[model samples]
Target chain A: MTDKTSAKVWENVPSPFCGIASDDLRIEVCGSSVRVLANGDAVTVPGFERPVTDTAPRIAGEPASLEDAVRRAAEILKEARLPVFSGFGTDVNDTRAALALIDKVRGIFDQARAAGGVRNLLALADSGWIATTLAEVKNRVEVLLVFGSDVEAAFPRFFERFVWNRETLFGQDPARREVICVGRAPSGDAAVSPDGRRPQVVECDPRHLPELAAALSALARGASLQAETVGGIPVVVLRGIVERLRRSSYSVVTWVAGQLDFAHADLTVQQVCQMVALLNKETRAAVLPLGGQDGDRTASQVCAWLTGYPTRVSFARGFPEYDPYLNDASRLLKDGEADALVWVSSLSPAPPPAAEVPTVVIGRSGMQFDEEPEVYIPVGVPGIDHAGHMYRCDNVVAMPLYALRDCGLTTAAAVLAAIEQSL
Target chain B: MTALSFTLKSPLRQRLDASPLVPDRLLGKSPKEIATLDLQYGNRRIAAADLFDIAGDDAESVRISGSPKLDFAGRGMTRGSLIIDGDAGAYVGMHMKGGRLCVSGSAGLYAACELKGGIVEICGNAGDLLGSALPGNKKGMSEGVVIVRGDAGDRVGDHMRRGSILIEGNAGMYLGARMTAGTIAVRGRIGACAGYAMKRGTLLVYGSPVSIGATFNDCGLHTLGFLPLLLKGYQGLNTCFSETRACRSRVRRLVGDLSVQGKGEILLVA
Candidate 1:
């Protein structure tokens, strides 16, 4: 005997949990609970069905009114000589409002989920990047190259949403697309293609990604090599991979920037870009640098348009000054350069970075804190509690976030805007 | 042509975006209309007259004197001449299709994003993403000429479909990265990952070069056929390229980026 209630089904709901930003999730809301129907993977369920809790604001571990909380937050910021505004796990509007608050306080701005994004931005800044979208990957990609990162680990539903689809508008057989995994290949069970085909595995050390990428680039360029093996791949095997890419109608080289642990990790990305560029000379090739979870891309996009800088910006001088290496929140806090922190994360359950200075946290409703801060304001979940915009991992398309239910909680933008006004 | 000028009277408290104050948009507008043009200062949207004192009325040639934290000074201008007498802000001459924009002082990031055609010259340093795409766009600076007299920040000529960028001073990393086709010549030392993922282009580095990425191969000493023509194209520009005309077509060419198209070249001044 089970209890079932009438549910309202919503289609094409975009999941902001991962970098893929799959928009095909079908959400079925019944009463206070929700269920993901179409393309509802393990990640999607938890990402959308997060338990709503803590509707009120708190100050010093005690429940407080919204106006009192705003006034207290403004007092902290106004008194702080060096304040770091970080943990940017909110939507586009929230980021804009946070920026406004940061400007008023003359603080530094960074992201909690910024390591991977910062590295990628450095790569992009170091050498320009070439990227493609999910639609392009689904329709045109005939060959896929995954370097140093397990595709499933980062974007769990990547294959299901963009690769193993039952219907492709281009009429290309999904089974025909070749997947090439380089460096730390996934096990047989984990590596099974969605279409039941076997993907080619190039077994190599993940640390040697730079060398492997170099060898692959040399092979793609048709440089005659005397060695039988390069970067642990046989010359013949490398040639075969190159030949397939040369003949592929469209090829895509993808990697998770955060997965790369090399001292000069961007070098590996550069090599991959070079390899893809070479392949494009013969046919058509593009790069898919995936990894922008927790609205990292959205934060960077909003920051760039508003201040002409992506992240790690200091407004202490009354103008946004960008310095990726210097303005890192953790770094500044640890070095005692920053005297306070304004941590904002409306999705992740992760806690704020511990610092000696006073911290004001505005985070997910369900987030649990190990050490209570000076003030904690629980904000609504973007794409669930409030409607907003978030940039996809590709950073090309920005999907609209939909509000599923009327959860009586304040939005991060509203709180931050209020704080600015209070200040 | 008669020149219209706006001299800043005071320092700005915030960034002032003057994208709407382009020459083409002001060509037919009266002096009063020009002063009333919209401008964005931080979150506040103010008018041109609020920031600067306007004098004369010539849209074909407009000059902005003093810095005042102005950005996008000559943005999206087509077929006109604009001059900045002092330091400028970011995105100067951005998306310029056809015009000549001269900045007497430094410029900030994305100075010439997605430029179709124009001549942009910066006498001082330029920030990152010069002649590159906007944040998410694929291609950058498809057609244009960008000359930075001083040092430049990273990712110059990144993902450029077609264009020419010349930096007289040292440049930051990723010079000519992901370039489909273009010409970028820097006389100063370049940071790491120069010509990375370059499909088809020519990156001439006269200074000490940095990591050329493993994808590139030393093609050895070879006489490039395009060098002379390329140098001759900038003959009258009074750049380092014009001074190297005596070298003829001879250059220490390292043809590579063999990883992609292998058509792109990283040439060193012999």
Candidate 2:
């Protein structure tokens, strides 16, 4: 631990926990303890302030050297017929190391957020989508349409940082933007414009979003529907929303994939994307699919660059085979196909899933598991104990992370590389 | 000539890709050569004789005792007959151009996906996206006849260009979605959102659907002259709809999915 007099402040430090990658945080570190002095929210504040409890590697809940733990993990992987690498909640370099290890062991790789990510991926694979980046939304969005999600609840600083900013790159007035919510109401007032204008909320059940999306698409495409009301909302109200979308210079349709919790929810995303595409024929419009928290976007971006597929990849065929359904990590574990599991989550205190097979965990410092894994190696958090790179929710840019403290812990990439060498 | 046979030794720990076992790929090869064929098992390739007990002489007809771990059982076969006696995994008869592929037990996801021309018969229930396109592809089952004797999962005939899918049991949600042209007939109940965003197709439902999308405008009941003709096409297929008594001329015709300006028709048998 460092002396209290050596407390140092870090300015403009980008976050690895929040999906937005908020970069203007001022953090002060002293003796392995961190405090967010400015620009902190519910997500980033807790992320930076979590106590570092575990500092030693263990073999079956008993203290062991890091080398012994890694060797044991490698031995388990070497003897297994099929292994799965899941819960990839680390930075880019660590994820790359994990993928390399999975290929060497002929294992399957999946992320913790793959269930939600796959929903968006299926819609993208079935029918392509027109999407935009955060920079575009911050600069030129005149109208924003949110579907089936409480934006402020999941993303605390989404509106304050992007929607109601003081200024933009262009000369457009940010206070004149229009916010519209459908299916689910916003839990807070963050969506209110700077001029104190409340957003128009179209109240309806989340299950009815599919029909509403379809109706909106039909109306935007100039088709007349015989139904007086669709999904319990008057067609006239939907028409008004469409007219506003048409009249705007630039409009963005956004949604959180995790909030769409119905069967075949990808169809709803597809319908919304189709509506956005149709709106583009007359004016400018695009889609913004949110929810890339827990390093999901980083894992997908890194894996896609290395192997041609995004996630749910298997190297069991001596080549990367992409199957979103067959390669699911949870399904593989439940079906008794995998003989061993290696879970990595260095960003948060998320534990490895309970499995009947032998399991190895390389996770955050304070993760508590219900059942002790075969091997456990506590690692340092990126941006807190070491420098790394992480991808934001938009997936177009990867921001560099700087260390804020001198925590005596190794990085996940180093441990995984050591395990691969032992194999 | 005896039909070729391969019996599984036991349950597999890893999935096996049996794409090379099709008849077109095995013609003129002796039993010794056929036994030496390499199959993908996990990260390595193993000879066919290591896992299966091969026998018989004829290559035109092939029979295999399937496990749930057997995938791509008859992929890209242009001709001949391939039969699976037990459960088959994903991608069964995928990209088949012409032939008869039959499974006596349940089949996994993406069965008959991207099939061009052939007859795929599954005696047990089928998983999701049956007779649909491969991921990122636009067209699915361009020309084929898929008959599922048991219940089928969701998104049946997705983005299909042309084909006929007959489901004897209930069908899950989003039946016949985004089909440009096809005929999907379900004998049992169907889940919500039938004929969603379909540009053109015919969904014949014998049992009441759970829910229909509001976009599908109800056209009332009608006695169509083409109903008998459509039922006659299933005569030699050995399905329950093949019987003459099963032909019902009167149906509640709902034409819509005006969401995509689709001209598809959902015929509910009355």
Docking class of 2: medium
lDDT of 1 by residue, A164-192 (tens): 65667888987677888888675433345
Residue A183 C-alpha lDDT in model 1: 80
- Residue B94 of model 1 has an lDDT of 81
Instruction: Pick the lDDT winner.
Output: 2
Q: What are the iRMS values of all candidates? A: 7.2, 1.7
iRMS of candidate 2, one decimal?
1.7
Which fraction of the native contacts appears in each prediction?
Answer: 0.17, 0.65
TM-score of chain B of each: 0.93, 0.97
Model 2 lDDT tens row, B71-94 = 998999999999999989889989
lDDT of 1 by residue, B206-263 (tens): 8854555555667777776767777788877778878764447456766666555557
What DockQ score does model 1 reach against the true complex?
0.10
For all the predictions, what are the DockQ values?
A: 0.10, 0.65
Off by over 4 Å in 2: A1-5
